[model samples]
Target: MMFDDLDATVKALFDDAAAPAELRAADISFDTPDRAYKPAQATVNLFLHEVCENRALRDEARVMTRSGDRYTSRLPALRVDCAYLATAWSAQAGGLKAAEEHRLLGLALRWLSRFPVVDERFLRGSLRTPPQPYPLSTTVAQTQEGRSNAEFWSALGVPPRPAFSVTVTMTVDPFDEADELAAARRLHLDSTVMPHAALAGRVLDHTLAPVQGAEVTVVETGARTASAMGGEFAVPGLAFGDYTLRVQPPGGPAEQLAVTYAADHQRLTVVLSQP
Candidate 1:
């Protein structure tokens, strides 16, 4: 979700900042233009340079949504630094072309520097009204340690050009693929009067303290439930069989457990040790 938001946010910032400059708004383009571009026109291109996983912020081990009592599984959210190449372009034919290019580059750098963090007002589209309004951190790193700028341009098959690099850290939510796939139906079931077994447990962290709001999913089946007050959860209608359970708690890492659920073994306790 946040991947696209990052793109929109970058472009919107350029557009909003260029309004008073009387310069045409920049766009997402290549470092080297394919066609002739106006010298006065300021061309800005943002490219995904690198993505480094952020481990400092709070992370969601498991993404979830409650439909009544059942909690469904969704991929875990990722916190990352969206690195990009903010390149500017202008024509070089006219005598004043060099001045115009410098002006364009200066405008972008100055306008962008205004906001150490991209303002919410400048954020447009999906990012304008994000569900998780975590303000991304932006930075300009001219010299990237251990990486060669010459090698970068060579790989792009273009001559070296002046470009500013920016990194924005964003929290991205996991995508639910359920909508893209066709729904399956259970057409048959045993009508026998046998009682299904119950699974109950309290999730705990490495400290052995209760972890609240954890979701316990039976991997063999999609049935899952959330840990409530005191970190307790129960699923009462599970059929008797060997079950693989996945335990995921908010603010904690997910865990996997192999459990055998017969008449003698019903209650289960799970603990998470790693993130």
Candidate 2:
């Protein structure tokens, strides 16, 4: 039965030639607390031993828990997490010997060595450390029956300890504000540019006050409408059309003005007369 199952599993892998690229033979979540998984060495050893021993369980298998052990005695299933089975059983098909088994196990270990281990070296050697404390209370106790528990711990190469939680944060910069309302009203009307009074200088001092966080949005009818983000904004590359100009000053009232664009090369002066 075990041989048949193994044969079927191997055949299935070969049959599925176009497996998804995203499919992972083994997956580990860094954020998640360590789950008690069978060690590659132990899982391989147990499965091979079971096959050789012919002590296969007919029904359910006993699974271990953090709190205690449960009993069922079901035949063990192969897992990518416990990939040692690939080599162990592959060699076990022939005459079973220590040297051959060791060689296969070494290869499997090398293959799995690519993954990072949590605690590679432990200083507390043979101190007979009591069970480390865990955050969650689970049924899979330390004293689990059969080789599953041992295999799970061995795979991690570390005893079950505890899990942790973490958080990430980000900071945003405040917007800049500059413009004075007193300056907007000081400008005298110069030449009539097109729609409104045309001024000489780049800007009318009192006409435009120190406006912090002010955004200018120019909407062109029958054309594209664009908005100025952050600092200062002005309409450029504009063709003759009716455009709606909107300005929003931080902590102040919003102003919207409509103007018709003509081929007069006109300059429009925007002034906030009232404070």
Among these predictions, the greatest TM-score belongs to: 1
Q: Candidate 2 clash total?
A: 33
Specify the poorest-scoring 10-residue window by lDDT in model 2.
164-173
Give me the candidate number with maximum lDDT: 1
Q: Write the per-residue lDDT of candidate 2 for residues 198-230, one digit (tens) a residue.
A: 211121224454433455556443332222231
lDDT of 1 by residue, 37-105 (tens): 333555666667678877776565655555654556666667777777766665455757666566777
TM-scores for every predicted model: 0.51, 0.21
C-alpha root-mean-square deviation, each candidate: 18.0, 23.6
Off by over 4 Å in 1: 1-4, 17-40, 58-76, 175-275
Model 1 pairs in collision: 39-91
